[model samples]
Target: MAPKHDLQYPKGAQNTLNRYSDRGSYDLEKVHKIVNSTPVLHVSFQPDPSDPFPAILPMIGQMGSFERPSSSISDPLDCYLHGYISSRVMNVSRAAIASGKPGLPVCIAASKVDGLVLSLTPNSHSYNYRSAVLFGYATPVTDTEEKEWAMEMITNSVVPQRYDNTRIPPIPAEMQSTQILRVTIDSASSKVRDWIPSDSAEDMANKEVVDKVWVGVVPVYETYGEPIPSPLNKVEKVPEYIEEFLKESNEEGLAYATAAGKRPLPVKAKTNHDE
Candidate 1:
C-alpha cells in the first residue's frame, strides 16, 4: 500500500490536545481514516429547544471526495451520513440553514481498540487504542447529482463492492425515503496509545509479582464469518468476488492485529481503522 500523505489540521480551541499531547495528531490522513474505519460513529448535536440536554446518535457514515472520486480514505473529504428523510437530525440541518443560521454544528467521534494491555500493577493497565473527534458544519444535500453519488458511496462502504454486487441503482421510492448530509469538517484531532505496559519500578523488580501474573497484549479484531445464502435463493455457489473479499479482509485484520501485538506502534500510515 502507498503511504498516505499527512496533512495537519490547524489547531484551534475546539481541537487542541491537552493530555498526553504527544500522542495527539492533527494529521488529516490519520483523522479521516479513523472516522471512516469506525463501524458506528457517535454524532452529537444541539437538541431542539424542547429538550433540556444535548443529543447524540449512533450513525453509520462514509467519507467521499466526489470531486476527486479516486481519493483514498486518508484524503481530506466530506463526510456523507445516511438517515431517514424525516429524521430529526436532517430536519434540524435544513431548518438551521433555512433560518439563515450557520449550518447545524456537530461533533463526530470514532474509536478502535487494538489490544488489552496487562501490567503487574492494576493501576497501570490500559488498552491500546486510536480515537478521533471532528467538529463540522452540516447541511442537507440539495443537488440531485451530489445526493446520488453520496448514496452509492455510503452503500459500498457497508461492504466492499456491495453496491455493484447486489443492485445497479436505487429505485425512486428508496431515494426519496433516504436523506444524506454533507459535513464540512472545520477541525479534528486523533490520539493513539499503543505500547508496552508501564508498571512501577517496584513491581518490575519483584520476581514474585512477575511470576504470578501474565503480561502481554491480546490482539482484538473483527473477522467475517462464513456466508449464509437466503433460503429462497437458487444459486448453488457463492460469488467469487464475495469469497475473495471475505478472505482478504480476514487476512488483513489478522496480520494487522498480530503486528500490533508485537510492536508498540505501527510505523506505516494506516488506511484501515483498528479499534
Candidate 2:
C-alpha cells in the first residue's frame, strides 16, 4: 500500500501511475518500459504554493526509469511491433540531476475501472476496480553496457521476441545522446472493489413504480475485429502469425489495436446506466 503522505500528491499523477502498475508495486521498470513504448502520455501537475514546480513538464518526465531483477526477462518490443506506442514526453531530458531531495524519485497512480455500483439504498453505492500506487526515485543510467542492457530490457518488456526481429540499438554517439533514468520505489498500496448489485427492500418494492424505465442491466465489454491489412502492402493472404495476433481475447486485442488505429469491438457486460 502507498503511504498516506504519497497519496497527497496530484490526482492526475496518481491516476497515471495506477494505470501502469499492473502487478502491484509502482514498478519502475514496467512504468518506464510502458512510457517509452506507448505514445502520448497524459500528464498534469499544478504548482504547489509552498514549492514552485515546472510549469510545462512532459508526461514522460513525471515518471523516471528504475532497475529490474538480473534474471527477469520481459520483452517490450512485442508491444511496439503490435502497435502499442509508449506514452511519454521527451522533456525528461531537461530535469535537474540534483534536486537536493533526500529520497529517490517517486510517483503514485490510481484508477477506477467501472462506474460506481449504485445500490437501491443511497448509502450502498460502491465502485468496482483495481488500483495501485507507488513511491520511488530515479537514478540515471551511465554505464555503456548497462545502458544497452536497459534498452534491451525496455524493448523486451513489451514484446517478447522483438529484439530478435529488430536491429540492435545504436552504439556510442546515439546511445550517449539518449538519457535513461532509473526509479527506485519506496512503498506501494493496492485496493479493489468487485461486487454485484444489491438493493434495499423498500427500493425493490418501489422499483417499478418509482421508475417506469427498464430496471435490468445492459452488458458492456471490449472486443476486436479481424485485422485490416495496410493498403500499400500486397500480401495474398493474412499471415498465420498476423492472424494469430488477431485471435487474442478482447482486452489484449484492444491494447494492440489502440496503436493500429483499428476500432476495438465492444464487449457485452452489464452497466450501471442500464440498471
Candidate 3:
C-alpha cells in the first residue's frame, strides 16, 4: 500500500520538539486540522528597535489554497490572516516587500485543550491538547479576487451560512479598511496529547495515591451560547439553517473532544465562492 503523503517540512531542525517527540508530527493534515479548528491563532514576530519586546497578537485566520481551490488539508496551502489595513504588522509586511524582501518572518501558534488530566503526583498533571507551531513569512495580500475570497471564507468559518444571511458583498469602504495577511509557511510541527494518565511504578505502588485520589480525564469542549435576536428584527423564527448549525456544531465538539483526535471534526457550511 502506498504511504500517506504527510506534511514534509523542516522537522526537529527548524522548530525542534524537545520533549514528547513521539507525539510530534509534521503531517500537513494533522497540523492543518489543529490550526483550522482553533478559532484564535497567536502570531509572534520581531519588532523594530523602537519596540520594547516581541509582538504577539491573537488573530483569526485559516489555511487555504487559492490556486488549487479544491486542495485538502493534506495538501500544501497558505495561511490567510485577517487584520486591519492600517495595523502596524500589516505596514511592516508591506514595507518588507518594498525593501526587496519577500515578507516578514513570523511564528504562528495555536492549540486546543480537550481535557484536564488529574494524576496521582503533581508532576504528572497535564493537559490533553492539540497544538501546532508554524514558522513563516507573511505578506499583505494585494490581489482583489484572492482578498475577497479570503474575506468571505473567514466570515463563513465563524458561523456557517452567516455571510449570506447578512448583507451580500461589503461596500468598497469596508473592503478598503480590511486587510488580509498571506503567510507562506516554510515549516511547521504539531503535537498532540490525549492519553490516559500513566503513573510511575513508585507512585502506583502506593495504594493511597492510586486508589484514594481521583485520577481521570475531565473532558473539555466549546459550545455556542443561545442565539440572541435583534430587538428590531423582522424574522419570525430562527432559521433552520442556524438552528441546525448549532445542534450539529455543538454535538460535534463534544464528540471530537471525547474521541480525542481520533475522529475528524464536522465540516462547517460553505459559502458562495463568487460572493
In terms of lDDT, the best-performing candidate is 3
Those runs of model 3 whose alpha carbons end farther than 4 Å from true positions after fitting are: 1-3, 50-52, 261-275
TM-score of every candidate relative to the true structure = 0.89, 0.50, 0.90
Q: In model 3, how large is the Cα lDDT of residue 261? A: 33
Please provide, for model 3 over 1-275, each residue's C-alpha lDDT reduced to its tens digit, 9 standing for 90 to 100: 99865656666577778676667788888888889989999999876758889899899999997899899989998999999999988988898888998899999999999988777878777777899999999999999899988988788778778888889788999989999999999999998876566556677689876778987777788898788999998998999989998899889888867776343222210110000
Q: In candidate 2, residue 245 scores what lDDT?
A: 43
lDDT tens per residue, model 2, 176-196: 566555444454445433334
Q: In model 2, which range of ten residues has the least summed lDDT?
A: 76-85
Cα deviation in Å at residue 16, candidate 1? Answer: 1.3
The better-scoring model by TM-score among 2 and 3 is 3
C-alpha root-mean-square deviation, candidate 1:
4.7
Which sections of candidate 2 miss by over 4 Å? Answer: 1-96, 99-104, 110-127, 171-174, 198-202, 205-246, 249-275
Error of 3 at 127 (Å): 0.6
Give the clash count for each candidate.
2, 46, 1
Q: Which wins on TM-score, candidate 1 or candidate 3?
A: 3
lDDT tens readout by residue for model 1, 1-275:
99956678899999999876777899888888888778898889986878888889898898788789998766778888889999989999999999998789999999988878776777767777889999999898878788889988787776777788776678889889989999988899999877655566677679999999998788777789999989898879988878988898789877766677777533331221122
Q: Itemize residue pairs with steric clashes in candidate 1.
A: 112-275, 113-275
After superposing all C-alphas onto the true structure, candidate 3 shows an RMSD in angstroms of 8.2
How far off is residue 56 in model 2, in Å?
Answer: 9.6
